[model samples]
Target chain A: MPQTHTFEMGMTCGSCANAARRVLEKMGEGITIDSIDVPTKRIVVTTEKSAEEVKTQLEKTGKAVSGVRITHIESH
Target chain B: LHQGKVSVEGMTCMSCVNHIQDTIGAKEGILNCTVSLQEKTATVIFDGSLWNGESVAEAIDDMGFESKLIS
Candidate 1:
């Protein structure tokens, strides 16, 4: 099964958002970040990693990352 | 010619990009400025004799934009 995680990251501007987006994109295969909303300070990513792992790694960036929610996708 | 790349964080939409670019471009010593939302970066062509990279970054910071020197 695949999953999508939404994270509220600390992105002060577009450059920072771009940096964080790049970091999350490399998480795993078939994983993709849907969008990064700067106004909401959110990084919406859909990945294969466990919800906890995604949150943990996202926090490791050492930024203001929190408010993570995961949605499970059934694999065919 | 001294060029500086100021990587800013938090700009989500074009409005933010416009605000930051407008603010920085208006600063003194900045000869040219290019902003990319995809790259999340602002490249400025300036006269080092007039201003330093720190100053350029500071200008953006003062405008409420999180900025760092990439170059």
Candidate 2:
């Protein structure tokens, strides 16, 4: 099953968003960045990993991750 | 040893501060790194012979935080 997770991060500019994207991309395979809304500071990612696990990884980027929500789950 | 300060952007909590401190502190030449969430800055003490402020700023940037050398 693949899950969609939404995280609220503290990103002040485009560079911050780009850095977050790079961090997630470097976290091995099976994780895809769905969208990053800079204004809202929300990032949505699709992956097999759980929301908690994803949150832990996201935190490594040095951005303040305020919240993580699992919005959707699909069986494959 | 040399002491320097860098301004950091986009930090909203202590975790962010801790992350920055840990990331920069882990570097070989870094002796101490203190990140302030309230000030959005980092004070680092390191071996000047082994590293420079630019590399420290780059490390913070690579970790997804914007950093600029203040001193």
Best by lDDT: 2
What ranges in model 2 sit over 4 Å off? A74-76, B2-62, B65-71
Across residues B1-71, which tens digit of lDDT does each residue of candidate 1 receive? 79999887666788667756765677677888888888988899898898877888766654445678889
Error of 2 at A19 (Å): 0.7
DockQ of each: 0.09, 0.26
How much DockQ does model 1 earn?
0.09
For this target, which candidate reaches the highest TM-score against the unseen true structure? 2
Considering summed lDDT, which 10 consecutive residues are worst modelled in model 2 chain B?
B11-20
lDDT of residue A45 for candidate 1 = 75
What DockQ was computed for model 2?
0.26
lDDT of 1 at A3: 75
lDDT of 2: 0.81
